[model samples]
Target: MSLKYAPKYRVFLFLIFCIIKACDVLFIAYMIKLMLNLASSGSKDVTELIKLATIAGIGQLFFTCSNFFYEHLKMTIIKNVNLVLKNANLNYLVAQAKNDTKSGLSLMTNDLKQIETGRVTAQLDMCYQSILFIGAISFAFINSWQMTVIFIVASIAPALVQILTSRLITRKAKVWANANADYTQHVSDSLNGAEAAKLYNVQPTIISRAVNSAQRMEEALRSMNFTQAWALEVIYTVAELFCFIIPCTIGGVLMMHGQLKVGTLVLMVDLAMNFITPVVTIFQEFNQVKSTDPMWKKTLRALNYSKNPHEKAIDQRDDFIDLKIDNLAYKTNKTNTEIFKDVNFSVTPGKKTLLMAPSGWGKTTLLKLMMGSKSPSKGQILINDQNLTNDWSKLHNYFSYVNQKPFMFDDTLRFNITLGRKVSDQKLRQVIHEAGLDELVKEKGLDSPIGENGNQLSGGQIQRVEIARALLSHRPILLADEATSALDPHLSLEIHETLLKNPNIAVIEVAHKISPAEKAMFDQIIHLNQTPTD
Candidate 1:
């Protein structure tokens, strides 16, 4: 949604303040003109000068208060708009493609920040400058229409300069934004792979790659800045020649010819300066707004993103969920390369199913499909006899997913396990025992900080924490994708037995290797291949 009309009353008040501010400028010009006339006429009376000074002082006071209120309103509007954009971008990101996620991140962080810092000020300035320019020019015309015409005509040069350079400024700004996104993505990737880089002794290589990305981003930023600076310099130079030099020269000639009074000449110069100030400011603000057009377009696009129109909401009734995959197929959206086809499976309530596949097979993909993170290219995923193709939002209500590398926040162990959900101490202890986390709890207590992404915990401990969370959720279906891959053999077997033995819940686990004893515990074993089968 456009924020053009946000905080309507405040915007109206700001416009009124702009008008008051313009009036203040005109009053000051009039007072200066009166003072000049008194001095030129050699009048001994100081009453008019005192009266003009008093009026100008009152105008200055009003101007200051109006300016303060205007700034306050502008900030409030900017804050509201920022909040709206943040919420819209977050909602869109949740449903966006993985490849596009980074772009959304950039928009929410850097792009929004730019709008806050630059665009908000530019918007307010544009409004104020336009009003001030009009008021100042009107007064100048009242003084001498002939000189006002010449002044305005000369000002066109600067406007033309801005118009010509605006496109290049916008183009450079877009390139910089894209480059910055790439740099952000690369930094995120490097940080996520820090452990791998360290273990492989490739820190130097990673650093080099990050430096190169930063350099590219820096170059783009420098280019954008240089372009903006050049445009401003050229425009300002042309504006100075017309707004100051030409007007003063013509006004002086008129004054010498006695067609214009010295007081009137002074007033015209002051008013013309006021008019020129806003005109120059308007051009600068226009360039600034134009430069941010790319970011604004990106933000708008993200906000406009809509899910598949054909997608329907699922019924949210509390019932046991039995999933069925009928001839499921999937392919890469970019390459159109089929990962798998004709995949068939069923996850019945109160039963354990094991999915086995070799490396390069679509094991995780299949699990994601079940969880509704991915959609099947062909066939249907039925949940409790209802098609789940487009109703992925409801999947969370029925299932708990335990990924291979479960993410943990930088919070206490208890917070990570409960995820801010209230749970009884008895139930929490029970799940911790079942998930083999009792020892860790006893050793460090539930209040121990887990560090970022559970870095404080070992791999087995992280997996166990994930299982405990899943168990605590009490969802009917538990989906585990290589959940025990990081655990030792004995711990892996214990976790597997714990999940499979839970008679009240349905479990579907994917693993490349499982012992025969573990395999026998499952009600069915499905192997994913070119044609998946049970």
Candidate 2:
């Protein structure tokens, strides 16, 4: 498949490539002179030979510099293309589904590496070899076009071999890349499920699964290598045989028949040796491309922008509005199962409310829907009675949804707390203290590093940090999904009391159980009980 690298960069790359090719002619001619001089008789002038060698050396230097420039530019093109695809202009389709972090991680690390460091680009380097082959042929024709016939005979063979090899390699690469992603996912799943694996005594099963997966991936890669090797063997056999016999035969015939000078005869031999250089190099490059293409296609396809579901509203509305939900319903695609159907709920202004639901019922889905993640399979949600779907831009302004699992970046804790919002240091400290994280933050400092996903922090501390973030932001509506589940009963009660005291704010907590005191703080309890049909 054709990679749609950024057009501007592609055009610039093509232009530079043209320049590189044009420069090749000068280098080829100079090389031909050097060949002829080396092939000359003992009577030939050494000073003249030295001059030709100097010219050839200069040409070689120019060629190397041009190649270096091409490599750099290609890297720039790849980077720009990848970035443009990653950061959406406005992707609607992607936002409708829940973020699959595992898949995203696989795409970023495993799949991306396959493409960037793999085969197709290797093949692109073969273009230079192709150019070299053409140059060698042109030079050979200068002394003996008859020898150039070798190119015509050998050309189709290489292409045919590459075509068949590429198809097999393509299939193998797909399997290999899939296995790579799967293996990465398995490691992620296993490590993430380490607690469960230990609890269930399934470490053996995990190890077996991991081993089998690695073996399959290894087998696929080996198969690809074998296919490439077979094709290369054919080319090498042809090259060695032709290079040994043809040039000498043609040059000898021309010399004996008095049709060519002795210097030209020697030049033909030298050119024949030089001729294989490009073909060999191009074949190597082609093989690299063969390996890289599948990975490239797979990764870039994943990067394709899936537009946000509420892109239009996000674009159109920007003002803050009160959080509200009307008739709301949702289902999962995997099972076509109703997560919650024909549901209706609300968190009106100036009233702190709690959403109580059984485990796995759809509290998180509902929160995401209200946040204008553009989810919920059916019904309408609103902000201040204004349809949230219709005005998703104001949803974030109106409500802060602190998920059960907080996403901490590799950056600072301070950055995560502020989240680029303009809150003062004192205000940040006050919220942290309110959320009961003042002690932790004091020890580490806000700028102290939090490892990936805050693996360094305890479950309780992470919860408090996220709560601190939501509190510091000061949104009118707070949507907390099992937010206090990580915290101890005492801390959860403190949080409940804090919300109760803030009468002007509205809160929606999706808790498995709220304490009697916490229960008293909430003005209303919205329950999602199983219906007859449910």
TM-score of 1: 0.88
lDDT agreement with native, every candidate: 0.82, 0.66
Candidate 2's displacement at residue 107, Å, is 2.4
lDDT of 2 by residue, 1-534 (tens): 223555665645755674586456536654665556465645467777777778777878887778777777666656665565444311322443446655566666765555555543443444445655666667677656765565445444545555566666667767777777677777777778878889999999987887787787778778877877777787666665555465567657777898876666555555655566566556655666667665556445545645445444232134434555666777776787777776676566667777877777777777777776646777887665666573455566667666667887677788777877787778987888777887888789888888888877877777777777777766677777887776788877876676556654578877767788888888888777554223
Q: Count the backbone clashes (under 3 Å) in each candidate.
A: 0, 15
lDDT at residue 14 of model 1 (Cα atoms): 77
Worst 10 residues of 1 by lDDT: 309-318
Per-prediction TM-score to the true structure, in the order listed: 0.88, 0.80
In model 2, what is the error at residue 406, expressed in angstroms? Answer: 3.1
Model 1 segments more than 4 A misplaced: 1-6, 97-105, 194-202, 306-317, 331-338, 394-397, 412-415, 418-448, 468-474, 528-534
lDDT of 2 at 93: 20
Model 2 residue 73 CA deviation (Å) reads 5.6
lDDT of 1 by residue, 1-534 (tens): 244636778778878888887888888888888888887898877888788788888878878888787778778877877887788778777666456646766787888887766576788878888998899999989888988898898888888998899899889988989998998888888998899999999999998888898999999989988998988899889988887798789888888888888988878878877888788788888778877888888777766777677554333346765788899888877888888888888877788998888766788887778767788899888887888763567665577888778888899999989998898999999988888888999999999998998989988788888888888888888988888877778877887887889887899888888888889999999877834332
